[model samples]
Target: MRRIATAVAAALALGLLLPWAMPATAASAPPAAAAFRQEVPRTILALVDLREEDTIRLSRIHTMVELPLNHLGLSVVYWNVADGLPDLSRYPGLRGVVTWFAGEPFADAAAYIDWVGRAMDRGVRFAVLGQPGVRLERGGRPVPLALANRFFARFGLRDDDGFSDLTYRSKPALADGTIGFERTLSGVLPGYPLFRKTDARVSSHLVMRRADDPASDSHLVVTGPAGGLAAEGYDRYFDAEYNRRQWIVDPFAFFRNAFATDDLPKPDVTTLSGRRIYFSHIDGDGWRNVTEVTPHAAKRVLSADMVRIAAIEPFPDLPVTVAPIVGDLDPTWNGTPQSVEAAKTLFALPQVEPASHTWTHPFQWIFFKDYSRQKEAPFLDRDGTYRPTKSDDHAAETAGEVSDIGRYAVPRAYLQQPFDLDQEIGGALDYFTRLAPAGKRAVLVQWSGDTSPFEDALAAVRKTGGVNMNGGDARFDADFPSITGLPPVGLPVGTERQIYAAGSNENTYTDLWTNRFYGYRNLVNTMRHAGAPIRLKPFNVYYHMYSGQKAASLNALVSVLTAARATELAPVAASIYARIAEGFYTARFEPLEGGRRWRVRDRGALNTLRFDRASATAVDFTRSTGVLGQRHSQGSLYVALDPAVAEPVVALAEIDRADRDPPAPVPYLVEGRWAFSALAGEGTGEGAGFRVAATGYGEGAMVWRVPRPGPWTITAERDGAVLWTGSATADDDGRLALTVPLSGIDPLILRLRPILRPSGGAAG
Candidate 1:
């Protein structure tokens, strides 16, 4: 601890530490000490046991509860119950606590109960799934009925010393409109009945009935202001053989009603500029592999070069973040001069955002948590090279730990030297930044191999001022067939968080890139599903540089990009998407005017907020501050906020009705292809106009809903140089359309001046 403090002090004195970076002391302690202050209470604490197979990543709660809560735009903070409950008071805007335990009870049942009671005392609601903590007891003896009932009473449930009716043949029945949604309820329900009766305040969503006894009906699911309970098998049904989960209880309705999340001001990351966000990122794998494609194959061109020539150069309208593996680009490793030159060329592109894929790609990141040179020595090949050998495969087959070893035969893709976290994270980031042009440093770090770096590794990436992304491998299509396949926005990695790539790469689609190379063409299906019905994720085109090795894989990538270009989307850098995801976890909201207005703060780079089922509402410009404009899509109103504003107040008002007088004209943004910031609107007379800084790709398509009907001259300028000037007339409803051709990614200043006539009418 003393050494850490000294190092931190030295770093602070030398100006080497970023303000947002996690210090060594903070990383060792509960992250809440640093996070809770700025973050809003939009997080649900999910409790699980690391000793059990059911963890936060692969538990019933992840597949059932987490997915639904994500749809409600909520973030999850996972806590291992064995670690004891964190100080809930330290965490602000904590919506509630959730628990789902299986098999034997927790090690200390009494302590668990006491912690839950303490949380309840603080007005933090608890949602129990499968086994309730109060019901769990040490040894064979049961918890006292008085103590158990006290916990149940909080949920409006009254225990009558009854537990499980094993012989009773019963089935679950959905209560009218409750319970069954998406997946229908079927088969006999498992019995471990707890409560016989409930208070009048309880709402029973699902009930169980006995086949023979008419009076033997028990509450399978119940909820109230205090929280809810779904007993045993009624919560979810997991098919162990297929590794799939089907919900017997509707997760959306359950979480919404249980947590009261219906009207919360959700910080949405999916939409921007009134359209779905589009972003692309490429992994640095296969950068040196020779292309097998036509034309490029004749010259023995590297896959990375071919990808730059074909996929990247053609797409000037889209921004793609290129993350190069430091081992592939640095000459000290196996990298050649050609590889280094390719990386320098790629990072110089105007549309490309430079990033790092790590120094040595660790295949099984968990193995390095307690790294041991002796333990890893056995896995290295006898030839001195760290590549996989026949012996390693035989050992893996005999050990039956294929999942533990990950995709590679060894623990890490590069193991020539001892594992060093600093070299793999910070060193790689610095190496990539040096390869980029001036003013364009490495903005993100893409996790390689297993993509599950430990807490310290994640903190190291944060310390370097880089956003960590990759992992989750989110996919939803006919093959995966369920929302359960879609992971949450990101994972809670102890003191740090890892932002996940929005969609899976070509490897998953092509069965590890062995066959069906064209399988990635079907990515369009996952992209479409992720958006429609409900916007669960943004449009992310994630792939490897190796896609250029085969014509089919490269074509599939081009096809997806073409489809993305045709769609109405607000294209942003991969770093922007990472920051937006970070915003979802850290953004704070203060609801005012009975939920009609919200003061959003500490949102990071997330510049858009969405209100679902708000077709009748519009941004009240007069009341709203720091608002750029508004756009409506799929029955949801997306309000664009100016990132320059420290705290933006979004006020929603009813749309002007026929019965009411038409509102005075104010030049307000309707929609734009470019991203806007530092927006300021002024004057309602002849000089009535607005000025905004815009940055984007392709031709800038924009429209403004003006305050009055008249001819308007729009001039776009950059550094006092007028790029273009055009005149257009506002329609009767007051919408003036304009276009500004964008040739670069830099922000341009746009000023609109109303061209008035003597008669205050249309002019030629």
Candidate 2:
């Protein structure tokens, strides 16, 4: 409970400007500000460079951002600034601008210079990603840094100007032997609208000797270590010829270490090394003298100031966040009957949200670059399917790659096909569309290898209502990138291994063991990644098969998820959570006098407006359809938006002031159902009964919500027949403890009544 409150407090702080938001009207207010009230935008512009930096992060900026953009509110129209700048005049309701600059913006210094000048003239907000710009020398002027200085000036930021501050979040403490490094990380400062936690997970990373330009108004949403001990360009610098050196030691090394990825069976005999005993005997606590397993890494308890690791187990009291990405299940990949059944059953649960990874999970971009020159388009197996083939006659082959004769290796030719829009997107969705249990279908498309598609491919996917997600938050440099801004940086062969999202967890799960930590602390990456005047961009984080691929990855993910679920940040499905994100990000708190202001926009979305006083709230309307629902969220009044509508709706001073603010919604207890609390007096009154709307919930499911701490009872009935009744005690802060099945609770007005006692005794 203390942790949840801390998280909420952080989120409610809103933005960098603090208690009061800075006037959207900048020093250079545009002529459009004349119609300021009417012209405030319901949209934001996200200009990205579509490129891949590392083999692990993937390329294609848009692939990973759909969920965040949609869930946050505000429609975004993407543009490649690489060609210079777009005509921003069309974005009348444009609130701010963000860019994943990378190395491109610097290369085209002249074009970006023009764009930055225009942005300043128009009083726009800008955010930046990656390093400000690379240092180019061996010539006349240090001009790249100068241009970066000016570009950031538009957002009230100044580069470090060759001055830098050094800070560390975690130290590389060696373990006694090989438990691995201590597997722990920083926590978050909950409640911040953007960052899930307040811990300087990213901010610490952004700390540089002389890289970032620090601005007072620019708050670091995330901060973490400068880099790991073995970080490239730091402890381990690879020269240009390093690749050639690997070839010499590679062949012999492969045969030397036989079982590196796995372990050999524990030897029955133990040699007395004098220091320790190894008998292959497992301790009662599973702490084997040889092999002991611990609980998930996130929950590992620590004592003596982090000297020891305690094995702990923690379960999800909140809804499970669904990754939805499932692969290796296509029939061609040995999808057996039992495997198919298990897949279906696992996804059928109300909690699991399914996603598509194409029928054959092919490595997208790398394979394309390696073999696109092949006349066959390598692995072009009918565009969507893979068939056995061997066109290469190369003698250098591994047993696995070759046929029965050797089977050691096959010729390195076309291994897998590139992005097949039709087979992968449309056909791949077929299983989900058919298998989805009534009312639900896969909404996200998980990419294979985080390969982003071209405009044509993206259009095809949008036509099917699927959104792409797989690329890292900012590493979009691999897929022949479709850069948005003016300058283009980084050659195709460039590699950036810095973990940009480590502010919340300074150490990777591996780092917890290895004691090597470094990161890119900027989330949204700018004036705190956008305009310093506004709150920071939503601190977004995610992991991939590489962040996991090994068993250690699971520990990393679980630890992170455990932290997220504990806070109010734990949201519903990606779709709904996306709406909430939209509500938060697109929220425009335009302050009027006397605590009167235009709350968050309702442009095809919903928003919650908290007030110090519930005194006679009146609302006006613009393009909004109608108020969908209302309740109390964490002690504040929340208005649910009907995303289906786009017209503006105003909540004037005439809105009702009621005490029936339910603490939270229990939409998770029963999927597809709307559950909220209302003050109950009798059975028939102005404030009576918890309205359980027939939202088409699933079977055998029940949902609920309570406003305040007290004993509560809910009786579900239909027609005149009482179907179900349940009771539970709420905490002081209104914690609904319900225990009942959906025998007949479909859609009914469940009037929650206080038990009446005969004499004054207790009644539950």
Tens digits of per-residue lDDT, candidate 1, 1-764, equal 01111222322333321121123453244323323233335788888766674456676676557767876767888777666657887667788988887754565666666777788787787788887866656354677778877777778777766555563466654364556654556554465564665678778987666664545667778888888888887777777898776676777678877887766777888876666888999988778777888887889788889899999999988899998777666666667798899988988888888888888767777898999788788877785446533242121121111122335677766667888998888888788888888868786888877777889889998898878999877788888766777778888778899898999998888877668999888899998988987788899999988888799999999999999999878888888889889988778776544337667878887878877676767777655666767777676677877666667777777784532122433455667777766665545445657666677777788777777667888777765688888877877777778777655376566777777667964454
Candidate 1 differs from the real structure by a C-alpha RMSD in angstroms, to one decimal, of 8.2
Q: State TM-scores per candidate.
A: 0.86, 0.46
Residue 162 miss distance in model 1 (angstroms)? 6.4
Q: Could you say which candidate leads in TM-score?
A: 1
lDDT tens digits, residue span 1-764, model 2 = 01111222222232111111123333123323422345344354666544324321232223332222322233345555544467888777664554443354445555656765786467554433333332322132355656655654443334444321232322222212211111121232111111121233322121221122222122221212211111111111112553210111111111112111011110100000000000000001101011112432343211110111211113212222122122233344333343344345534544444556444443433343334435344334555433434322211111111121112122221234433447656776777656656655655554443233334544555578655443322321221121111011110122111111211221222232233212212211311221122111222343322222123433444544444433222122333333333333345433222223332333222223332223333222221122233433222233433222232233434445444323322211111122222211243322223433221122223323433345667776554467777776655645454534552113343445444356633343
Name the lDDT value of residue 542 in candidate 1. 94
The candidate 1 region of ten consecutive residues with least summed lDDT is 393-402
RMSD of each: 8.2, 18.5
- The residue ranges of model 1 lying beyond 4 angstroms of the native Cα positions read 1-40, 107-118, 144-147, 159-178, 192-197, 211-214, 372-376, 379-405, 591-595, 654-665, 682-684, 727-729, 762-764
